[model samples]
Target: MTNVRKGVWRMKRELYKLLLMVLLAILPALSFAQGDPITQARIFVEQKQYEKAIDIYKKLYDQNPTNADVYTEYLNVLIQSKDLKGAEKLVGEQQKMRQHHPLSYVDMGRVYLAAGKDKKAEEQFDEAIKFINGDDLMTQQIANAFSTLGRDDYTLKTYERARDILKNPYFYSGPMSRLYAKSGQIEKAINTLLEAGPGQQGMLEDTKATLLEFLGTDKKNLQQAQKTLVKKINEQPENPYYAELLTWLYTQRDDWDGALLQIEALDERNKENGDRLLEFARYAAKEDKYEYAIKGYDAIIAKGAKLPYYSLAKSEKLGVLFAQLQANYAYKPSDVATVQKEYEAFFAEFPQYYTSESIRDYARLEARYANNPQKAVDLLTKALEQPALRKDIAGRVKLDLGDYYILTGKVWEASLLYSQVDKDFREDLLGEEARFRNAKLAYYRGDFQWAEGQLSVLKASTSELIANDALYLSVLILENITPDSNFVPIRRFAYADLLTFQNKDKEAETLLDSLLTAFPEHPLKDDILMQKAELAEKHREYARALTFLKEIHDKHAEDVLGDDAVFKIADINERYLKQNDEAKKYYELLIVNYPGSTYVQVARNRLAALQTGTPAIP
Candidate 1:
């Protein structure tokens, strides 16, 4: 009997163990049921268990009456459940609890509007606005609430009331103008924004941004803005801001001549010693408005040589002329000579400018357009000898000299110069650029191992441009070298690249084409296409460049150069072809297709400008 009892006790222990395992298996399910109450309530609400959700919310609200999230979600659930009386009671309680806070009134108004109580909703909205004491936060809350309700009219009223109570006419003008523009009251929008004139604190750029949105390549709207700005300028002739806006409007309309006239008038009226004109000229130059830029700079130069702006105007005008000629593929030898003579005359007049940026510009003109790389080398060499030259300036001179050396087929000299700058500016972007150039020189000379070694280090460079270039070159070397040690294809490709760098573009194209025919399956095909595109761009053959770039984009989009091709295509379309629509399309494509690309931010900025009808300054 005792033995039988022992067996029974062992069986009982086994049963207990089995029961404990079953409970452990179900523990997770029980834990899930006891998870976050709000989440559980939301799940129940989604399943149409409104009663359960309301119970949870009621408990939450009871625990913390001032918890806005709990109250908002609870009220939302009640309204969705068609418990109108409950929702109304909840909102009313909240209103009383907060001394009828304006936002609570807005909440009540939203409820009334939901219940088809239009009259009561309007009353509630009016009450909310009446409570506005001109406090910025309160006014913003009331206006934003009305806006959220799609009651832009009430939003305007709220702002208007706040403006009146505050006795500040320009109060909320930025937002108010947007409202006016949204309702097609563009003239009212314009007037409201400009009424405060130059005294409108921080509103000018906001107003411009608003106008950019509405005026968006609309001829009629642009004309309307122009007329309004003209009237404002006339009414407040002393308000330079009005004149500035008028000038900006003219630019938006592409009436650059009109813009220049306005700037000149402002400069003369303000007795600014051509400061404003100089600024306008610089802007025009940056926009590639060469004709008007030259005109504006000439205006400044006519102010007399002894005036503060005269020397600057002369120097800047030379830059414009050089830029104009550079951009003109069909420019004459006489045009080159004319610009060269201007540089010489300027240097003759101001010998001290040998150390200035103009000297580098002069060297670039001599080497690239004038076909005098030797002369350019000589010129920059002399500039380097200047006493007390800025280290950065000296570094830049060396880099430019290196390029001229490449042009002159002095490869070793160019490498040496780059190495000097690389050592001198060891921790600067200038140094990174110099290192990258030396690496590129190595790649050009078929020293792939050395070039790859240098590029690996530069892939972590602080300069985005340098790092991107380094990464590309490093990948190119790594990908092209076959396991069997065959370097023929990549070697020829690098040689072609070197030819292109040396301005032997025809030779480069020939070599690249031959390589394609010889090694039909080479991976350097996209690279070759990119090089050809760059060559076309250099010669201003934008259509040809687009053809090459489009091929790379369509055929090798998943490759490393995809974003580079897209950005270049967009740039060519916008800056050279003036195809704004095509430019916008490519920019948008880059942003959507290459979100992780280095060019994403620039693409977004350009796309925004294009969409807003203010194409970026190329």
Candidate 2:
């Protein structure tokens, strides 16, 4: 019997030990659950420690009975803890103190709603809405309190009551429209936002932004918005706001023609100096709506050469013509001749443009498209002699002259010109571009070490484009150098890249394919594909280019050229293929997948413009 008693004591000790260990483990969790007083109270409630949470709330309420934040928090804790009587007393005291305030009524209604007393809750909410005066602050507070309680219907009622008291139709339009949209009342949302008068022009942008958020590329919603805008325009014929909104709606639907027509009507009605027309044309040109852009520019030109915008119109029209020609991959020699005639006429009329970007673009046309590098060289050389040319323009022209020299086989002369610009603008973006060109010339000649050295220094350039290029070239060099110093593959690739730059497309393509055929498993495969894509793009073989880009994006997505491939694909779709939706998808993919890419910001901007149907204004 003694041994049995001893065994029983041992068993009891082991059971107590297990129970103590369990408590010790949970004690840390309990302590960790106790954060700030309110957080601790909420955590305790979530853990079903309602009594403890109520005690914390009761203390908090006693410490700051009149504070709204504290009062709301304490009331929420009580309601969540199902302490209905405590919640009633808490809100009742606030009502007695703030007899004119409507939030107290809202709080009481929330408590009643939690208790399933729907009729009582309705009555309390009604009483709160009646307490709304003409005070904007009080009205907003009441509306927000109701919104926070998930009582959107009462929230709408509160805003409507305030609007009636203020006698303003657009008083709560912003919030009310959002509420209506959230509740799937599309027509009401559109109408409520459009109801604002001319006096509310300051809120126009905000109203548009709200519409963008809710309407969001939905075909039916966009159509409804268009109808509402049309109705508003008709009702308020003199209001430019409605007309502008309607034009923007047209753009959102990709209806550039309609947008241009609307802008033309507005300009004519207002008897403006083609300022609005010019702005609209510039936007359209940026969006690749070349036909409408030309029409808009022609409208200004037709206003006569004596007008303020006549010369500007002529100059910009020449640029648009060049851009149109460049965009047309199937453009004929006649197209080039036609645009060249426009440039000659503009330069003949305004010799001052010899110092502008127009001159550089003209030179590019002669050298690149017309295959007359000598003419380009002579043109830029004469432009450089002009005394009125800005220092920067002179530098840019020198760089272009260098490129033309390269095209004309004046390799040493090209080097000299690049070096001159590099020396003159040693601290500018122009200088950086000059340096990159020199390095590229070196790479073309298979001087990899020197080119890599120059590129390494430029890897941190202030210009993002130059820095990205430098980094890419630097990485390519380091990646392709073999252990035994074999340079056959990379040398051929660099030469092919140079050939592509020189517009020898067939030779470049042949060399790239030979490199791929010779070295099937080379690290340069992706780079070769990228070069091939560039060659295809230059030739306007967009579908073929897309196939190559897709290969890189799929096979080398984690490689250095992955984002480049994606961005190039998007660019081709947006610029050459006219596939805006597809472009948006790839841009979005770049943003989501390669957030660190140098192209992310550009991708984001492009994506935003595509999604919002508006270009980002500089």
Candidate 3:
């Protein structure tokens, strides 16, 4: 009886072991059932096992004929499998139960299209459109379905048929434009939107942005739009928007003269309040279109002081003229005198501007170019006394006044002003400028170690201009100062620089010559040569400046000043001597030999301008 019980227990254990083996054998198949059958079918589709997916979907469809998702998905799979007959039979079976379903006809059309039976496809598509009669929802579904199938022809016809059946003037220009662009009919796309009229004009910018997205920076589409704008202007002469857009196109093409012409015509035709002219003037200045900018500003000034933008235009015009002077560097004393009279008259008429940035330009012109340092000092001092001067503007004025003092040999007075500004604006650009100026003042006074210490801290200044000036001065002092700590030649060079700033060209020249004689083999040779070149350039001695620059370029070609000499030579030839060919040659040489030089990019740009007849971006 015990043996019989043991046999029974062993049999029970064997039965349990067999059951566990069966579960493990079918575990993966059972995992498929963990999700819905449709999910399993999708997984099979993802794996590209369409036959297996179809079998699973077929079982699901048979279980629930009312499942529209299953029905539609099964038919789509049939088409994807290239089984047009199977897709047709599925649709027919669905129609028997769902005769009023709109997607039946759409599916039939799609199936026919897949089979390349155009005649049958057209019939089914026509039936689908009939259901969309006067209904935007039906139209959208049909059109979007056709689009999903890449059948834009049927999609377009659906929209057209809907509009006719609804008897509505509504047109789908926005969507149609997208369709046209996709089909490579970009011109048609632009025209369709334009013809959509003012109700849809707000989409114009978006439409153009999309068109430009295709061919970036290719102004061909813009020119095409220009042609349309011209036609619109001719057809509707009273419309100013088209004129403005045309002007904008011209400006986009870097054709400032063209934009200027259009802007002037609009201003004359509309009798505007100088607002448009003033806006265009500022735009031209921003684009470096100085000629157009000057013309625009003059137009506003012609409106006289009675207009709203007159004072603003006059102020901006003063800066623009000074900018033109700086950009060309060809300003004569007579030019400065003319602008100087305008500046005096403006300040005399409006003393309130003394507290503004515009006042600084007058002082700069007077002191730096007009050779009237005392007049500049008096004007700035009067401007500083204003009770409502902004702290920043006051700081800037002090800094400028300090510079004038340095130029006029009042080193102690300049040091006081610089210290005042430095103390007041401790962490601002004004402070940085003041600190740099003070360091330079120290350098000028032969305090090399102290100046070097101050400049080392300023090399990391947040203001790029102050940082660069500090760095250059630091480098100049370090590179030229003798190992024995003798600074006599540097001190004389600084004094010569001061003299040059003071318009004492002859004295500065004499000092530079004496320094060269005293320090024949000194490391300050390149610096002395640069000083002489600057003095000669300032004195309108282009030939003399070329000689000095040539000496540095040929003898000191490996020095820190070599690139500077080459760049300065190119600049003089381009601007002062107007030797375009020579300027091109020098710029090319610098670009070739000094590929890593700071001036290489500017030289390349200038070379481009010389070769292309376009304005340099400077």
Winner by TM-score:
2
Models 1 onward score TM values of: 0.74, 0.78, 0.67
RMSD of 1: 7.1
**lDDT at residue 45 of model 1 (Cα atoms):** 93
Clashing pairs in 1: none
lDDT of 2 at 506: 92
Deviating ranges (above 4 Å) for candidate 1: 1-45, 49-117, 135-141, 213-215, 329-334, 409-416, 432-461, 464-501, 504-618
- Runs of candidate 3 exceeding 4 Å displacement: 1-189, 193-227, 230-243, 250-272, 482-485, 536-558, 562-615
Query: lDDT by residue for model 1 over 1-618, one digit each (tens)?
Result: 699999999999999999999999999877877788998999999999999999999999999999999999999999899898999999999988998488888889889988999999899888888898889998898888899889999999998998999898777888888899899999998888788546766667877887898778899989998998888777878877778888888888889989998898888889998999998888888888999999999898888887898888998898899989977867888999999999999989987888888899999999888889999999999999999678899999999999999998999999999999999999889999999999999998899899998999999998877888899999999998757756998999999998887789999989888988988767888998999899988877888999999999999999999999999999888887789999999998998999999889988888899888878754
Per-residue lDDT tens digits of candidate 2, residues 1-618?
Answer: 699999999999999999999999999877876657888877787898888878887888788787777677777778877889889998999999999877788888888888999999899999998988889888888888888889899889999899999899978888899899999999999998888645685877787799999999999999999998898888888988889888878988999888988998999999997989999889888887888889999999888888899989988988899889976778999999999898898889989888888889999999999989899998999899899999988999999999999888787898899999999999888999999999989988888889998999999899988998899898999888857766899999998887777778899899999998999889999999998888888777899999999999999899999999999999988877778899999999999999998889999998899888864431
Model 2 worst lDDT run, 10 consecutive residues: 609-618
Number of colliding residue pairs in each model: 0, 0, 0
Q: Select the stronger candidate by TM-score from 1 and 2.
A: 2
Better of 2 and 3 by lDDT: 2
